[model samples]
Structure formats: C-alpha cells, structure tokens
Target: MTEFMFSLSALCRDSRARRGLAAVLLGCVGLVLPLAAAQAERIKDLASFTGVRENQLIGYGLVVGLDGSGDQVRQTPFTQQSLTNMLSQLGVTVPQGTNMQVKNVAAVMVTTRLPAFAQPGQSLDVVVSSMGNAKSLRGGTLLMTPLKGANGQVYALAQGNLLVGGAGASQGGASVQVNQLNGGIVPDGAIVERGVPTTYAQNGMVRLELNTNDFAVAQNVVSALNRRFGGQTATALNGRTIELRAPTDPQGQLAFLSQVENLNVTLPPARARVVINARTGSVVMNRTVMIDEAAIAYGNLSVTISPQQQVSQPTTPFGGGQTVVTNNTQIEMRSDNGSLKRVSTSANLADVVRALNALGATPQDLLSILQNLKSAGALRADLEVI
Candidate 1:
C-alpha cells in the first residue's frame, strides 16, 4: 500500500512539472496565460469614443399601481395638479377647489440614454425616479411619458411596468425599507420617436479615440490598423485620438473598421498610480506603484479631560459652620510609541502595504502618512485624493 501511495505522488508531481514547462514555453512566445495566472489588467475593460456618446433625455411622468405606497396628495401638490390635468384631457370635469387625496399616484421624472445611431421605433431602457414626496415605488407602473432632450424635442415615449429593486412594509406608523425608495427601471420601455441624424459610414474620414492618453499605445494602434488594412490608412493625431480614412463603399468601411477594433495589440507599461479617498479613508495602489527608500516616524498624542463633582451636607443647618465642597478635575495625556522605519519599495505593491502596516497605523492615519510620503518625494506615483 505504501509503494502504491508513493507512485501516485510521483505521478502528480510529474503532471505539475509538465504543465509548468508548457506554461513557460507559451509565455516565452509572447502568449499570455489565463487570467488566473496572468498579471493585473492595465487597459480599460470598455473604451468609449470621445465624441461618440449618448444623449440624455428627460421627461415628467407619473407612476401608478402602487400598493398604497405612493405619494401623499397633501404633501405633493404637483401630483394632484398633474392628475387633474390628465383627467381633464379625458373629458372628466373636475370642479375647481376640489380636494384630491390620492394615494395610488406618484409624480416621477423619467430619464433615458439615447445611444448613438438609435433609429425611430427602436426600444431603449428608461429609468423612473420619484420627484415627489413618495414613500415607495415598488410594484408600480409608469404612464406613457414623452421624453425630450435638451433641445426641447421629443425623442422617445416611455411606458411600462416598473421594476423597483426594493421592498417596504408599514404597520401602525412603523415601517421598514430594504433598498432605495425612489427609483426604478424598465427594460425596453421607451420607443424612439426621433433620431439625431449624423453621417458615420459615408464620411471622408473616421476618428478613433483611445480611452487613455498614451502616445505609445496610440502609435501602436495606428500601426496595427495600417498594417491590417493598407499603408497610410490611419494616422495618430494625438495621444488620445487617431484619424483614419474610410473606403467609399459603406459596407467595406464597416467591415474594415470592425476588424481594426478587434485586433489584439499589447498594451504599453502603465504608469504608477495611487488613489486615495479621503472621505472613506481608502487608499488603493496599483501594481506599478513604486517608492524610493525613505524613513517615516509619525506618532499621535491624545488628551482627555474628565471632571467630577462632590456634594457636602451643611452642619446643623448652617449653625455658624458651613461645609465646603470642591470640584475634582483630571487631565490625561498619551502618545503612541513609533520608531523611524526605513521602507524601500519598487514596482511591488505588496511590499508597500507591508511597510505601511508595520507602523501600526489605522486607516485614517494611513492617509496622512501617504500624503506626507508623497510630499517628501519618496512616493514615485501619482497621488490623487478624492
């Protein structure tokens, strides 16, 4: 039995060696391993064109069909006014000064992003948010609302059942909520009624915008495009944008551009970056962050003041003798014991974190230390505090 176990162990070890060899060979040939073994990502997951972006559309609407969780008519007078107007349009004669106590209606603002090349009759998702004193929008249905852009032109019409990602329960003036109380979304709820016209395919030239401003990456992109298509087809204008000439035929240019976007080019080495969120005391360092050798010694002093009062009884109801009472106050001071530790970090973020942790500082204290290090020219990375 022992011999059989040894054989099994040896077989496992051989398999691991073979896998390692194969991985090394693939890496030597400039092929990356899977994400589970490869380095951290430097390029963005999704890139957007600078000028090619979405247009925002907004409209005033009403959400209905809530389970007694809608806006209070007395608090939100606009909701009552809107309902009266809607009823009047339907030939319902509501007399003036008639008090409306509606609990099933909510005034909402509808918003949607119109993507590039959205044609008429195309469907788009819409977000509906309560703009009134509404309790909850769960299990609600939005009415047909005409969405308009900044130019006051109707772009789409939204009308669908809302999918609110929350739940609320109330009983006898006690209530509990699980998620947001005001917003919801409807998938494919808005149909485009108008489209902004712009020529993209038949234009003399097309522009490609890189998400990051890197001259080396932009040059590589241009070279890759020209190599795939033809010579002088693409030129790098700046670190962020590239201009390319398109074919006369629409289909040819579309096919050529589609191939150009999918070409996998190796990204350049990224710069050292560090992001600090002062509000939440968060510090994030990228893999490329580096630090020079430096010594840091920081300590915190805390002072506390406590007061105590004592009461004394009068002797024989103030018979020519009065008892005296005194107030006792105490002050305490404490300081942390920290040493000057030298830290040297380069390219590896683990070492930097370890050095910082050795100081026994809290998250709030780490922020100040990072700032001081950056100011002292020890940190060789961009320090961004937000």
Candidate 2:
C-alpha cells in the first residue's frame, strides 16, 4: 500500500508538469504567428480588377506646316498618296500626270490611350510619330483624324498643335540635333466620341487578380476580406485570383469595392531567387537566398602579342641604298596564382555578397563561378540567366 501511494503521487506531479510545459509552448506559438503575418499591403496596391484596363487608339494622319524638312515625295510614294487624298477631301483637285515637289507635309501615325470608364467628350493626350524621312516636326499641326478601336468603330477624334521638345539646324551639309524630332505629344488633343461596352458590376461576385501569382497571398486576401466583412463573403479561386460576393446595384458595388481596396492585407514572404543577366554581366539576388559551405579557386590566363618595328640606315648618308625597316613580333603570357579557399554557408544576402566579393574577380568571372556552383549542387536557389 505504501509503494502504491508513492507511485501515484509521482504520477500526479508529472501530469501537472507536462500541462505547464504545453501551456508555455502554446504561448510562444501565439506570439510568433502574428509576427509572421504582420507584413501586409493594401488591396489596391497588390491587385487590379478585370475589365478596368486601358484601350489603345491609333489612326493615320497628316502633319503639315514643316519648313522645307518633310518627306521627299519620290522616295515615299505612300506619303504622296496620303497627301493627295487629304487635299481631295478638302475640295482641291490634283491634275493627273503632274509631279508635285512639296516639302511642307509629312505622313504620321497618331496614337493615344482611352482609359476605362471614360465617358463622351473627355479629353486624352495623343502622340504623333512620323512614318517617313521627315527632317523635323517642330511646327507641325495634326489634322482631324478619327481614332478607331479593334471593332472598326471610331472612339475618339484627335487634332491639335504638336508639342515638339526638340530642335535641329543644318548648314553647308552639316547638321546637329537634340532629343527626338520625329515624335511629339499633344496634351488633351483627343475627344472621346464613344465608350466601350463593359460587363463589370454585372454579376453579384467580383474577382481580384494579383500582379504576382502566390497562393499564400490569395488565401490571406480572402481571410482579410472575410474578417472585415463577414463569413462566406470572400473565397480563394486559385493561386492568382480571389472571388468575393458584392452588392447587386452599381452604386453600392462601387462603394463596397472602394472599401475593399482601402483595406490592408498581409503579404507572404518572397521565395529564394537569383537573377543573372548574361549579356551585361549583372547579378541580382533576393534576401532569402543562401549558400552551402564550399571551396572555390578562380584565376585568369592571358597572352599578349605585339609587333616591334626597327629602322636601320647605313653610316654613309649617300651610300645607303634606302632606309629599311624591320618588323619583329613579340609574345608574352601570364597566369594568376590560383589558390583554394574554404567558405562557410551564408545565412543572408549580405553574407553571400561579402563572400562573393572576397574573390576579387570581374563580373564575367563571377558569372562562371555562380554557374559552376549551381551545376555542382551548391546553390540553394533557382539560377536564372537572362
């Protein structure tokens, strides 16, 4: 009976101790979980809504008022054709079989962007670029041209004085210029004549697409939206998108989306990656990248060769047949002292950079070293050569 009582007392003490340890561990975990989820960004900064994108507007137009610096009608027949058609539209008749030598007009292409949700009579900036060998477009005026979309419908009409921020001068076959003279921009030169049809706010659900595809970010977005609004309000559709229930009416939908956009959600940490530009010998790495302990040896081998010229003449000035020059080639070679040094695994980007800089190699040599490390299974991150 005494032994039984002793054993039971020991068991009770152990049970209490175990419970205390579990409580302590749970407390530590609760503190760490929030810190891991503390880095957050606004919804508007991380995602964009579908059907709310810009539309490209393009049209062919004529740029006139140039001073003897326009396309040659003989070299660019298209410019001549365009000019003839434009003149005909303005009640001018061109005689057949007549050669025109005008140097004051240029054929150009006008481009602009029609933003989403744009209404009629709104102004947009337009860009005009010359399509021929026009010397300059400093004082050109764009004619009235209708900008069309993919549906063959005119969405805007662009026409205004070009804002050329470039200048040039030519004299006696010498020319000098600054900036670009062939391209110019006109501020608020296009008037929106029509609006593209959109299906946004049609359904009761709104979809959000992330700029970067990350599953953790998508889940976090869904969770944050749900907590802010209510349950079943938001759900993750995939790694790149999240779907949320919204109001049916247009006004309410806009207000709800505005709120959602302002709400901030935490972003997950980035993955380990390394980017290398082969052409420029540039190296870029993220913080999460690490290296395993390894040894490396780098060296350079170079050979130099040049021609040495020597001129010989006889002591007698008139007796020498002619001054003769001899050329001899000299060759030299060099090799650096290559030694192996041990490097431990690096914990962060700073340490990795320090270790790499210790080799005193050029960017091209470093490229070879990194590639070799990846091939040898020492690098832990993805090696991308672009």
Candidate 3:
C-alpha cells in the first residue's frame, strides 16, 4: 500500500511539471506574436486616395533688384522685351527704338504645387529658377507672376523677396560658389486665386491606389479594413486598386477616412530587386535579394607611353649640315592577372553582402559581375540600371 501511494505522488508531480512547461511556451508565443504585429504599417503610408493629389503650376516672371547680376540685354533679348512690355503697361513707355540696358533685372520661371482642396487666399511656397544668363538671383524680388495649371488657367499669384541659399564672390578672374545660385525659394509667397475641385467620396464610395502594384498588399488592406469596419466595407478591385464603401455626408466621410488610414496592416515581403546607378557606380539591393553560387574574375589593363626627343648636329664645327630633331616613343602595356573566386550561395541579405565583399572588387567592376551573374541565372532578383 505504501509503494502504491509513492507511485501516485510521483505521477502527480510529473503532470504538474508538464503543465508548467506548456504555460511557459504559451507565454513566449504570446510575446512573439505581438512583436510581429507591431511591425505592421499604417494604410496611409502604403496607398493614397484617388483624386487627392497635388497639381503642378508653372509661370514665367522676372526677378528684379539684383546688384549687376541680371541678364544681359544684348545676349537675352527676351529680358529686354519683357522689361519694355512691363514699362508700357505701367504708363512709363520709353520712346520707340530706345535701348534700355537694365543691369538689375533677371527673367525667371516660377513653379509651385497646388494641393488638393486648396482654398482661395491660401498661401503656398514657390520656386524661382533663372531662365536666362544671370550670374545670380540673390537679393532679388520676384515680380507679380500668375501661376497657371496644365489647363492654361491661372491658379495663383506669386510675388515675394527671393530667399537664395547660396553665396558667390568673383575677383581677378577667380570665382568661388556654394550650393546653387541660379534658383531660390519664397516661403508663403503665393496666394491661391482659384481652388481646385476634388471628389473625395464619389457615389458613397472611395478608392485607394497603392504606390506599388502588389496584389497581396491590396488584399491585406481590404482584409484589415473589413475586419475593422464590416465585411462589405472594403473590396479589392484589382492588384493596385481597392474600393471602400464610405459615408455620403462630408463630415462622416472625413472621419471614416481618417480612421481607415490609421488602421495598421501587416505587409507581405517585398520583391527582390537591385538598383544600379551607371553614372555614379552605386549598387543598392533590398533585403529579399538572394544569390546562387557563382564564379567571378576581373582584371585591370594599363598602358604607358614615353617619348624621348633627340637632336643631331654636325660633329665638327662649321660643317655644312643642318641640325635635325628626331622623336622616339616607347609604349608599354601591362595586365594584372585575375584569379577566379567562388561565391557561395546566400539566403539572407547579410550573407549576400559578405560574399560580395569577399571578391575584393571595386563598385565599377562589381557592376559587370552582377550583370553577368544575372545572365547566368545565379542572381535571383530584377536588375535595374539607372
């Protein structure tokens, strides 16, 4: 009877230990799940509402009040013509055929963007760039320029003192400059004369367009919205478009959109891609990029040329022979031997970077290797050369 009692006690202790281990594992899983969820991104970042975008406005105007850094009238006749027209409009017309050489005026192009739902009297920032042969635009004031949209309709009027972020000095045929002297900005320098009409909610519905065309992300967005609001609140129209049922009233629609944009959704893994800048020899790759085992070899070839000049004269003085000059050139060519290197297969970004660095090649040489790897079906990513 005592033996039976001891066995029962041991079995109970074993069962309790198993239960405790299970609870600890569950706690660990709980912590991991939330950490993964925290990495999700808000809907506003991945997509934008249709018809809610900025419109580009462009205008041609003049920047005046420069200190002898304006456009030369002889070289740029447009400046002279613009000045003449402005003077005539102001009831101060010069006599016909009169040469008006102004050294304080420069022609510039003004550009700005009109935000969606912009109201009249709203102030906007404007960019002024030189359109003529002007040395600088510092200490200049932009004249009244009417910014027009693509439809050729004036939307805003820009006029303010230029805020140039560069300085330059020239003396004794030597010049020093910093940043850019040809362009400047004016903060809150433009007032909207007209407002653009936007249809935020059309027919009691709104559409969301993803910046990247990924069907998985679109579906995830719809799922997130539906789970928050209702089953029929969101629907995927295509790989890039998602339609949502919204309130018809403007106030309710605004609130609904605000909430919808704030909701977080987990995103799928990004596509593997590598971007290469041909001019600067820069290579950039995403984390999803992977490479298979491959072999690479690269070498450098150098050529050197040396020239020697020789003069021939008569050995005896007063000999009837003219001195002649001859040139001798020596050319030498050398090529460094390149050894074959093996690149191991990489499953992660860090491993891939380490493997590429082991090749001891410059970025310019890496470009050719990457292209060849892609051709050989070793690189499992899209290669884009910019």
The best candidate in terms of lDDT: 3
Worst window of 10 by summed lDDT in candidate 1:
1-10
| lDDT, candidate 1, at 122 | 100
Computed on alpha carbons, the lDDT of every model, listed in order, comes to 0.80, 0.86, 0.90
lDDT of 2 by residue, 211-296 (tens): 99999988898899999999898888889888879999889898999999999998776788889999999999987788787778
lDDT of 3 at 339: 74
Residues 234-329, candidate 3, lDDT per residue (tens digit)? 999999999999999989999999998899999987899999998999999987899987777778889999999999999888778888999999
Error of 2 at 149 (Å): 1.5
- How many angstroms is residue 241 displaced in model 2 relative to the true structure, after the best TM-score fit? 1.7
Q: Give the TM-score of candidate 2.
A: 0.75
In model 3, residue pairs whose N, Cα or C atoms come closer than 3 Å (at least 3 residues apart or on different chains), thus clashing, are none
Please write out the lDDT profile of model 1 over residues 1-386, one tens digit for every residue.
00101243555579786687667568756533453344333223323333556899999999998878789988889999999998888899899999988898999999999988889999999999999888888889999999999999999999999998888788899989899978999999999999887555436587777777889888777776777778898888889877878877878876766766666565666788889899999888876787787777878889999998877766677577566687999999999876677776543676677767766778888898889989999998899999
What residue runs in model 1 are displaced by over 4 Å at the alpha carbon?
Answer: 1-51, 172-174, 201-203, 300-335
Greater TM-score among 2 and 3 belongs to: 3
* Candidate 3 lDDT: 0.90
Q: Report the C-alpha displacement of residue 196, candidate 2, in angstroms.
A: 1.0
